[model samples]
Target chain A: MSRATILSAILSNQPQTTQLPEDLQFDCPAKAAVTEKFIQMINLIGGRVVEIQRIEDINLYATAHYGAGERLITPIEELDFYTQFAGDEDPHQFENIAFAVFKTHFAVAENGAVWITEDRMGARVLPFICQHLGMLVFEDSIVSNMHEAYQLIGSQDYGFGTFIAGPSKTADIEQSLVLGAHGARSIIIFLLKKEL
Target chain B: MSSIKHPELSDIFNKDEERVNWHDDTLWWIRAKRDKAAHGISEWELLRETASQIKNNVLSNLHNYLIEFEEKAQKNGIKVHWAANAEEHNKIVLSLLQGKGINQMVKSKSMLTEECHLNEYLESNGIDVIDSDLGERIVQLAKEPPSHIVLPCIHKKKEEIGQLFHEHLGTEAGISDPQVLTETARIHLRKTFLTRRSALTGVNFAVAETGEFVVCTNEGNADMGAHLADIHIACMGIEKLIPKKKHLSVFLRLLTRSATGQPITTYSSHFKKPRKGQEMHIVLVDNGRSVQLGREDFRNSLKCIRCGACMNTCPVYRRSGGHSYHNAIAGPIGAILAPNLDMKEYADLPFASTLCGSCTNVCPVKIDIHDQLYKWRQVIVKEGYTSSAKTVAMKVMDFTLSSPTRFKLAGKIGRWTLKHAPFTVNNRLNLWFKNREMPEAPEESFSEWYKRNNSI
Candidate 1:
């Protein structure tokens, strides 16, 4: 088979193996300012950030903005929805989703991306198929950069995962900015405030 | 310059002065955005170094990593296929689709598939494949190859794309707004995604430590296509593998920043195990990578992450346009890589660069792109792959420069001819005069001026 031939050829020609670089060390300051950076970056990438105190505030924001009959879906039990997703269902049935919200494990400050896995998303397609997407992250669950984000995700097991940064966007046509491409037309980050 | 019918393809692209200038300015703006993004990260240079070292380790132990990757991916219930070349890769995809009795598929942006010409191959085999990326879809509608890797239809103007969408997707005439055009595509491709039974995507990184593969996209097209389809096929080159999943931190931070200057693409989804009742297949394609690996001097090119930074920052590429390179991937990186695939056909590519070193400076993994471009030139000339006219010109340049008397006399004659008979050097035979007018003969030779000034 071609596999053996290709492997042997690579072994013959490849340079002697070199060691991977040591674990990266960040000497930069601003590690404590991750929350500020996350808010700034998310806004820059066209995602709106709403600071709220209670879990119920998400519904307040959604109800104020969305019409009554819109198909708004969320995993948050406090919020109203037509049905609960059992995490195992046909993805095709989720089409025409006006808005979908889910809780994230943590968020990255450097890129405004929130880490969400299949457990949080009933289906892998829910985050991307909706017209609008809302990701709720705990105020304290923010990391400075990807290095720390990976450290938090160390040795974790999941079927699927992603870091959703911004709403789907494209500059393909003449470098023109279009907010919604195929994914969510808009992304709103509902940053929950800590209660005393 | 390589063909009898077309004078250098770049020259043809240059005929439209307005388009050429617009293309140059647009890419340079993207390069500026890259600079700003890279500066935001304090550890930018260190990250580049770390990525480079990791890739060096990957290349040296690629054979081991490939097998480890195969074992893990198969254990995850993902079928792994090995393709020796482009033909076999295409055949594997066709059989997979045919076995399922599916005739249509949706694909995301995978430069590997572009390198393999998968769409054309699939179409020939009676399968319909729609490219879901907006830029790719535009060029696909035009039935033309993508000019830029990251921005497939960068060479096109808004009016032209509006025209394509109007003809193909039934948009109203004279709709030149990019927003309108993009929304039209979103609605059209959404249907294709919902209805298609098969989806094929290109792998960005295949982790050896785990069975997972990551597909990054800004449009979320890959997720839409793969998640909805019954059968999912992901193709990757042998060189796309890394030893562990942790290394992704270094690459993910560098990838989008260097490309389009976004902190990260909108979606960086990791696919490990297939969903229940769904099929996931990965084709580990060699397709001349082994040969490129055996080439000791050029093997480092296999570490490319397919980011378009080099093209955006390349001076020659920006002005001359991507079609000038005449390959699936265009830009400085492609120049070095194209020659590895076919020395005879791509010998002209290495000569396309100005050796500006801008491409190397912006390269995320710190590929010595200019040096590789220079090295490929030497190999091409030594292998006798250069054009006969160029060979003779180089020989003449050598013969004249080696002797001072001949050099001085030749300089005198060149000045005399330029001053007395401009037509001789201003004709089509003069390649330099093709794209630009010959500079007026210098008032006097530098040496002559030096000699006169030295006496004072």
Candidate 2:
């Protein structure tokens, strides 16, 4: 077949196998539980959590959220805020945020790690931005190694994907272990109950 | 015009032994970063191998893949252009801008543009181009090419950058802090980003399966420029394609770790389809790459992901500096690749290295950069492309080294002369003695010492 036809056939078949998971549904009790879970998850990932009654109210953690309050929300805004904030304050804050919230299909509970598809986050930046990142995962999605993670995702979709383990940890300066030089400092996994 | 050699800068390498040491340390620092990031994942080496194989497949099937990418891109309302050479690439890009009647453009970091000198070409044709990436902008303001690929203006000190920002961006004249300087560039480029009608970017990888191109940058400049511009142009060489999306996982794993030691770039953007009312174009430039592909021994050089891991790990590139290579690209990888584009013009570049294998060792995709440099030296010598002085020296050495008696006699006389007359052998005028002290001759030569010690 012609390359165009082959590509179209590939792309047309893509959505069939790889639909974005359906909008998550939650009961009132489940919602309350998830909220608490999210706060606990954030704390687990090294972010100090402050509760706000409404989403509009700025939890100092939320108001000071890197990309949250921007007029023109280009992907660049989030990236700019993180780059400057990382260099100025704790560099790992942005990375920790990126690790926490950006959607992930897989999580490794053993190490409190997250495996993100490239589609949910832009190629590399999503994993590096955000001070405290929250990863939403179905309980059954946990994997032992990246090899199994790759097999489960298959080979068709996602422009680029990465398996990020924990936050930006480094031993670069004089072999002194420095956690989070440029990427996430901590990764929090929120394992959701699997749907029937 | 006579090869544009930088003999003056060569003195820096010759004078300070410390230059080599600093170079080694800087590269090793980057190398250490790579190790730290790679060790985080258990399958890191396997991923590197997979990425390498995928790229190899792309290169072997490049001609077909380009045709495939062009057809799909065209169907998606994206214009695809082919340039057989650098001059052709420049002409194609200029004509595209001219066709749109756009005279101003904001560009993200595209090394292909650097290779084609796109900004200079566009300026000559009266199109003003602004580099949006802070590192690129700094190098552009300094009127110098990028010294390093990922960190373009890495050679510039913070004070120099502060001064540049002060002059151009109206920052406080005395402030020399990096954070302040970077913020100034950020504010300045924001205005350029909003105003420019067109944007151009370089492709990190182009997936054939999606007809999408990926760009990774620390700053989100590429995404900002593409999102705001009416027209988006992405320039890439034919060698950038990989077979599938899952393969990207492998490359993404290796690229950032090898480049900046980050787990991932701050922004890795995938432009699958143009936004509403935006025109997307992909320009594939050959620029002697096809000829490079034809050479069996040197073809693997094309497999470079341009992570610059090789440059960061190369002892020669760090000491000699990027400008010494005299090309848009530099370092050990550049030394081998530059000669393919212009052998006689870049004859000195390949010989500039010490043939250390650190570049090969640190390369994520495992490009045999040092070996390629060695092969290029052979090609240059065989083609009679070297300087007359070098040619004469090589021939004289070759004649002496071939004869055992002559070699032994020359060594004995050299030791006798050095021991008898210290000043004659050691002087500032001698290039080898400029930085390194000639060791004081012992009472006897190594051969004499060995012979006497063993005999006793």
Q: List the residue pairs that clash in candidate 1.
A: B1-B8
What is candidate 2's lDDT per residue for A139-170, written digit by digit as tens?
Answer: 55565433344456664354334444444433
Per-residue accuracy of model 2 over B1-456 as CA lDDT, tens digit each: 443264555655446666556555766787787887778766666666666666666666666566677766676677777777778788878888898899999998888999999999999999999997777888898889988787787666567777877888899888776545655665577568667888999999887765777887655677657766778999998778876655665676688788867656544566666654678888877777777776867878888999988887776676667777788888888888889999988888887778878888778887777889899989988998887867888898999899988887777877777788878879876667865888765566677689999995
* Candidate 1 Cα misplacement greater than 4 A, ranges: A27-32, B1-7, B434-456
**Which candidate leads the pack in DockQ?**
1
The deviation in Å at residue B394 for candidate 2 is 1.5
Give the DockQ-based CAPRI class for model 1.
Answer: high
Residue range B330-445, candidate 1, lDDT tens digits:
99999999988888888888888889899989998988999999999899899998888878999999999999999999999999999999999999888788769888888788
What C-alpha lDDT do the candidate models reach, one value each? 0.90, 0.65
